[model samples]
Target: MKIYIEDIAKYEGQTITLQAWLYNKRSSGKLHFLQLRDGTGEIQAVVFKGNVSDEVFELSDKITQESSVEVTGTVKKHDRSKIGYEIDATDVKVIGESVDYPITPKEHGTHFLMEHRHLWLRSLRQKAILRIRHRIIKSVRDFFDNKGFTLVDAPIFTPNACEGTTNLFKVDYFDENAYLTQSGQLYMEAAAMAVGKAYCFGPTFRAEKSKTRRHLTEFWMVEPEVAFFDIYDDMDLAEEFVEYIVQEVVKHNREDLEVLERDISKLENIKRPFPRISYDEAIEILKKKGNDTEWGADFGGDEETLISEEFDKPVMIHHYPMAIKAFYMKQEGDKAACVDMIAPEGYGEIIGGGQREEDIEKLKAKIKEQGLPEEVFNWYLDVRRYGSCKHAGFGLGIERTVAWICGLHHVRETIPFPRLMDRLKP
Candidate 1:
């Protein structure tokens, strides 16, 4: 029977055929050890000259790295194996031969590996990262689904910018100008008005010229909006939502985390009630750290990193200056009722959100104050005009969160194909 490497333990002691590729291989005097991978997992296939026919033994010895083959073997229990199981090969047939694969079992430069990212995914480390990423995505959906939040998709091609026009990716929408969405928060607000609680999960684009490790030209975001929710409610939800995602990943992707060498202890400690500090307090921390930051200035990468180092868990900095925040954010006397959740270990801010301004006149005045196109937001204002209630939401960057969870230094490896300012190839 045909079997996948992940289910090899179920057929122990039975001869099964595995459609796999040669991941690596080595040979002793009369025996060949072929490292095989079938996408689900990897295993060592031992081919002995005395146990198998001469043809099978010769074929196993000559199989190159990444060569596709059908390996028929007895699934033997091996207590000391990395996967706790091994395949004793009885026959092997090469379906295709791969000669000189670019990504060999050696260290490669970041640029070289990025150029070959299409093929580089087959590597064990890359495979593990992608698998963990899959779990993260699934966990996100499951968390919201169980919490009674409906999935509402936002448009990729937007009529106006959601965050700001400075970093917008503009496009020619036939006769009128359009832009790729920077966030789905605004559309999600409308969905929440109709559905009570809703979220949008999709790709967003930003035409930023930043060359930092945390910046991506195009990335995925999950924005959750809830009607009749206040700033404090938003903070409470953010903490619980993040903890749920981290715990779910730790539970399901333990083996993948081991492959990535992530410290599970750090992830395990991420529980509800994350440290929440005010913006004024965060500024004091930055000043004490010798950073050249002022109270009114927005926090950059350096500022975020210094502040996040104060705690082992994610930190929430709230009550930012109104002038520095988005126009839709509600005002608390003199400050904007907004929050930014900085990830621990210098990963920077993964979540930014606040209670939205629900008053139609205040929303319009803020739009005019920010010098935004008033005509495009008429529909947005209509949401407030037609019985709008207090609402709150937050957007979480998927790549940044995945990088932090997987203990990766950069965001490029978190996604299958990352679109950066300079990269658009395979």
Candidate 2:
């Protein structure tokens, strides 16, 4: 009775019971053709007036789209069927009936579909995107787990801001103020010192007001921190990690990829040893491309795309100016302070990481130079004061990565329930 929709293909010449919802139906006088879907797949059921009882025939005629039903049918091979299988229904029992579904099998506007995202997710394309997202999440944990990286959970509520308070979502935590975490890198750094290597994967929040296809107020980020690692080692790990995730999705979700209409050739070219470029070199390349960018400023979205276009695989741009990077990033001599590596092919900075300053005196001076309260980060500074080793880490946005791999224009379609700056619902 609880058979999957996919199992109907092998049940030829036998009576089977299926519980599903009516996806579509066509009636020709006394004959009826019904399409049933149960999440996994869809199957066509043919009901004839003369082959079944009057009650069953009438029930099949009255069923509407999305009406939940239980049907008893005999399976038969049909050459005309789209899936090479058909069911001849002897009985039909309607369990639930929807009043009037808004979504039909026709084209609809993006705003309309996003407004009705709850019901829109029942469509095939949305289902495939969510499934691929799940695969990416699984692959992330699997890669870190196999590499002996401990899974450390960072607190959603924190006392101090990792970057700054400008774009942080502030919340009232009892009497004090707490903000939603923007990245798990800081907390994972301490854990990495304790556990040798650690990674944290969870939802992060940002109060950015930008309405871009690539931006989200609430997104998932996976941050991996390692002690005794330098910027070069960090870049190497980032490339290999990204390559593994892409390979896993390609290996396991080929059919889902096809449903999403992704060009697998682009992802096939994504592998380890992504092209690495320094901040100075990227500036030179951008200058040649007629981009009005300076050496110290961070790369704009368009500039990042242009630089990534020059390489076949993902590109890593490292050693950014200290003033342009986070306060915690270690300064490289007198030229630059931090390093950042970006993915090529228009992925746009999939990995943001750098070497952290481990010296207590240097970190204290840098915190003051950034005009941040040292008391707020006293605990963070304790790591450097007591026993700290050279450490490096990076945060990879899960939605952006999935959108790039699946070739989706908008990041919202990649997640089942996307929480944007203005929209937050089913």
* Best-matching candidate per TM-score: 1
All candidates: CA RMSD (Å): 1.2, 1.7
Q: Global lDDT of each model?
A: 0.92, 0.86
lDDT of 2 at 86: 86
Model 1 TM-score, 2 decimals = 0.98
- Tell me the deviation in Å of residue 333 in model 1: 2.2
Error in Å for residue 345 of model 2:
4.1
lDDT of 2 by residue, 264-345 (tens): 8888888777888888899999999999897678788899898988998888888877777777888777544345555656
Model 1 stretches with alpha carbons more than 4 Å out: none
lDDT of 2: 0.86
lDDT of 1 by residue, 1-426 (tens): 457988988999999999999989999989999999999988998999998998888888788999999988899999878889998888999999999899889899999999999999998889989988898899889989999999999999999888664588889999998999899999999999999999999999999998989989999999999999999999999999999999999999999899899999999999978999999999899889999797799998988889999999999999999988889999988799999999999999999999999998899898998899899899998889899899999999999999999999999999999999999888
- On lDDT, the candidate that comes out on top is 1
Model 2 misplaced stretches (Cα beyond 4 Å): 80-82, 335-341
